[model samples]
Target: MRALALLWGCLALRASAALTCPKEMSGFEGDTVTLRCTYESELRTHPKYWCREVGVFISRCSSKIFSGENSQDVMEGRVSIRDSPGELALVVSLRGLTLKDSGKYWCGAQRLGPDEACPVSLTVVPATAPEATAPEATAPDAAAASPPAGSSRPTTQPDSSSSAVGDPGPASSSHSSMPSVSIPTTRLLAPILVLLALLLAAGLIALSTHMLWGWRQALWAEDAQRGEKVHLPAAARREEEAPAQAPEAEETSAPCRSEEEEEEEEEEPDPAKFIAV
Candidate 1:
């Protein structure tokens, strides 16, 4: 019985030495963390797995989360496990850590007999808050210190009653006397320049329209004068031909009238001889 106990103790020590892992690990909320466990060379072909402890006793791999096949990576939810046979190490990664993720976990390897496991305690802490930044102070404008051109600086005299009651400090006086922020001259001039440009463009357009109307009216008047000049010569020629044609018509009518009078005299000439019969 004593020899059997010694052999069992040596085997337990060997198994403990074969599977080794960190005792504790920590990560911030919303952060990722990696845990590595080294194993003996003889167990390199064994399947490796990661699991979370469920009960208070921290049983070995009670809730398996990820299991690795051969040397390939296996992932379940936010936890992933990968076995590197060359390095004889099992790597497990947990991403997007939360406060509830802090607990006891186990890294284990499967064998024909009992599985070998190592316990790891994880602590997930809340992320730290960022510090507040104070606003920067702005220096007073140099231009505001001097009065503008063509303007007299206004002077203010403190009331005698107020001075007698309490003397105002320099800080208060300086703060109260600080000039209000004056708008930039460029900002004020921008709209004025735009308005002036618009007025100038309107004036130019009106002037052009008036000139076009005047040119069109002059063209119509010129056409009217040219038509009148063309008709005037033709009217004058017709008037001159009318007077010459009128004298010829008068001479032809006078010869006809003399012949008619001679016939009338010859027809009435035998009136004396007929009255004697």
Candidate 2:
């Protein structure tokens, strides 16, 4: 009887000493979650690993085990672990967690055997369910909050209409009849802009013509120097040959000559002063 009692106590101790884990952890699908298990400080150097719980029993780590040297670590496809060389802890990381990953799991240090494992329970929040709960409340709030614009319409618009009818109120009248009593802001500026554009175009055309005329003059001068006659355009030739009317030219130039020049021209030498010419 004494031996059986001692055996039962040891078995219970082993059962209770399985890997330690949280009561529950919540996660989202497609997110990473960590399941941390703390162990006896002396087990720090031992290999750490985790696996899915099977029938409430854990014998060894899963076939995909993560064990490395005391300072380094190991990883499997989606699961990884860290055995802190000094701390009494092992952090097991599950990457790309999915809805299917919610379940009971066990973690252990390799040297501690299956009976010394820790239990972890993971719960995933259904990512779709929150939208239904939150959006339902917000939709009514959004609709109710929309009539702010209509709130001022009753108090303000009638005053503007009264002013535009006969109240001699410039501000109110402008506000009420803006569409009908208006000139385009750009209307006056449009003709000025067109005139300026035309002036600029004419200036550019005159400059181009002047440059071409200068080039022709230079070529003609060069040809004349080389004893080659260069023909002028007909309009240019006619302009050079045409003279002002004689009477008009005399009238225009009469006052320009000095009195001394006219007097010298009128005093001709007498034939007797130049004897026997």
Candidate 3:
């Protein structure tokens, strides 16, 4: 019976400990809201502190009103923390909060004894005002202003009467009006004829250049043929002159070879003369 009672007590305590801070809470720009956190009997020894976490940095705001000794900056003068006569309350009065103040706030409870800290989340939803522009206010009024909501008077404008007479009818047969159109005539054909004559002269010049190039090419071909015919006679004369010079040059060279052969024969060592020496 004692063991069963202990088990039941543990289960009940676990169930009660599950109650934590609210997951999310939001308020208007000029309103006040409480980021709430409470403890079960198991965690009553630890005091709870509500803090704001912005980009891995945590700032402590309120604490200890829920249970044990805790600290907060609000305990000074930046904010006010109050516990009513009966309610376990954390009232945070924010003044004119903007979107910059919106962030993840943490309600962390640190145990008095050696125990791990537990934390819950609080999301601040800062209110926003409808955007306005000076241009929007100064724009032309599309619709006229309405009367007071309860008034029964109609808003329609009064009908306007015509003041101008009708247009004068077509002119009588006594007078006739003729509209005249003046056409500008240019002496353009004379300039165009002059430009065509200049173009014809340019074409004649280009044709003369082509004929001159052909005549130059024909003269070059004739000169080339005459040079080829003269080359044969010139080469024949050079060949005849070369044969006449060749006889004299070879006659001069023949004695050198003969003298070399004679010197070689005379330089042969004689066996009998060598033995006498």
- Please tell me which predicted candidate would have the highest TM-score against the true structure: 1
Ranking by TM-score: 1, 2, 3
Candidate 2 on 123-191: residue-level lDDT in tens?
Answer: 553332211112222332333322122111111222334333665344323322323211222444577
* Model 3 lowest lDDT segment of ten: 167-176
Question: How does model 3 score by TM-score?
Answer: 0.31
Off by over 4 Å in 3: 1-19, 42-46, 54-78, 83-95, 113-257, 262-277
* Tens-digit lDDT string for candidate 1 (127-214): 5332222132113322322222212223223333433456534322442353333123334567889999999999999999999999
RMSD to the native, candidate 3? 30.7
Alpha-carbon lDDT of model 1: 0.66
lDDT agreement with native, every candidate:
0.66, 0.55, 0.42
- Each candidate structure's TM-score, on Cα atoms with residue i matched to residue i, is 0.41, 0.38, 0.31
Candidate 2: clashing pairs of residues: 18-117, 19-117, 19-118, 20-118
lDDT of 3 by residue, 134-190 (tens): 222211221122122222222221111111122212211111122211111123345
Clashes of each: 0, 4, 0
**Candidate 1 deviant stretches above 4 angstroms:** 1-15, 57-60, 132-277
Stretches of model 2 off by over 4 angstroms after superposition: 1-19, 56-61, 112-114, 129-277
Q: What is the lDDT, from 0 to 100, of the residue 39 in candidate 1?
A: 92
